[model samples]
Target: MLNLSSHHLQTIQAHAESTYPEECCGLLLGHLSSDTKMLIEVLPTENSWDGEMVDVLQVVDDSSEGKFSKRNRFSIAPQVMLKAQKNARDRNLNIIGIYHSHTDHPAIPSEFDRAIAWMEYSYIIVSVRQGSACDLKSWTLDDNHQFQPEEILTVSL
Candidate 1:
């Protein structure tokens, strides 16, 4: 399960609403134990998938849709993730999860999400409808490499 403070939850929701029609991505820095993950911070990052550039991901996007669509894809630069990891380490924390928005869709993991997810990190999906956050859910990968629903416990700051 993932436990996040109410303030962080609001931050995530606001990020999702602000990026409506395009997916927003971020990192969750926290401490992880055998039974629970405590989220301490939310670090929003740019969606590198739709950035102006000719790259391997852009080639894949072109073959799939003829144009890049932030609604369907979200990417974070390696440097951004590395920086976040370093920051977490400096704070004696770990990157325990990630959060993203699903514009006009349910708060559920897509096939692409499953393909890209690591084994132990929580994946939070927030659904944005009409520029508002509608639903939120968390998921984690099981031993079979399939997504399983995870509980979210909101704590008062």
Candidate 2:
């Protein structure tokens, strides 16, 4: 199970709302104990799919011709993730999971999500409808490389 404070959930919802029509992505920093992953902080990251860099790439790469849009895709740069990992280690925490928002879509992992997910890391997805966050769900990749639903335990500060 994944345990997070109410405030953290609110923050994630707010971020999802603010990035309406586009997907928002971030890292969840926390420590693990037995079967629970306790979330300590949320580190927001820029979605590369929404940036100008991708636009430039599409012009040069034929394979990326029709892809690279934020409405259905979100990507975090490797350097950003590395930095977050190092920072988490410095604070005695680990990047236990990643979170993203699906605008106007259900909070469930897609086929692409399943293909990209790493084993043992929680994947939290928030569903934003009409610029408001509606449903939220957590998932983890199983040994068969498929997404399995995970429980979310919200705690109060």
Candidate 3:
């Protein structure tokens, strides 16, 4: 289960809505208990998916011929990941999860998301319907690399 304040959820929703056609991405900094993750901060980021770099995403096939955009793809740069790690370490928080938005789609994990997923990290996805945020969901990768629905506990501040 993932525990986060309503404010955190709102921030995610707002980011999704504001980005509209383009998808938004970000990191979740928090503490992890036995089976629960408590969010401490929601760090929104720019969508830096250049669509030319399939190598980073471990795409062995040349399926993508550089025809993608922020509307359908999102990527956090390695430098951003390293910097986020350092910030979390300094604040004694772990990067418990990552979050992104799916424009005009359900808040469900896509094939691409599953392919790039890492273990022990929650993934939050928000669906933006005609520029309106809706249907937020969280997921975690299982032993078989399948995405399992994660329970979200919205707590009051």
Among the numbered candidates, top TM-score falls to: 3
Residue 135, model 1: Cα distance from true site in angstroms: 0.2
Across 1-157, the per-residue lDDT of candidate 3 in tens digits comes to 9999999999999999999899999999999988899999999988888745555664633476465678878998889999999999999999999999999999999888898889989999999999999789999999999999999998975
TM-score of each: 0.90, 0.88, 0.93
Give the candidate order by descending lDDT: 3, 1, 2
- Output candidate 2 Cα RMSD: 3.6
> What would the per-residue lDDT of candidate 2 be over residues 11-73, giving only the tens digit for each residue?
889989999899999999999776789999999899876557566545444455566578777
In terms of lDDT, the poorest run of 10 residues in model 1 is 53-62
Which RMSD values do the candidates have, in order?
2.4, 3.6, 1.7
> How many residue pairs clash (N, CA or C atoms closer than 3 angstroms) in each of the candidate models, in the order given?
0, 0, 0
Q: Give the TM-score of candidate 2.
A: 0.88
Ranking by TM-score: 3, 1, 2
Over 24-84, each residue of candidate 1 has an lDDT whose tens digit, in order, gives 9999999999989999899998988754533555443345544556886788889999999
Q: What lDDT score goes with residue 83 in model 1?
A: 91
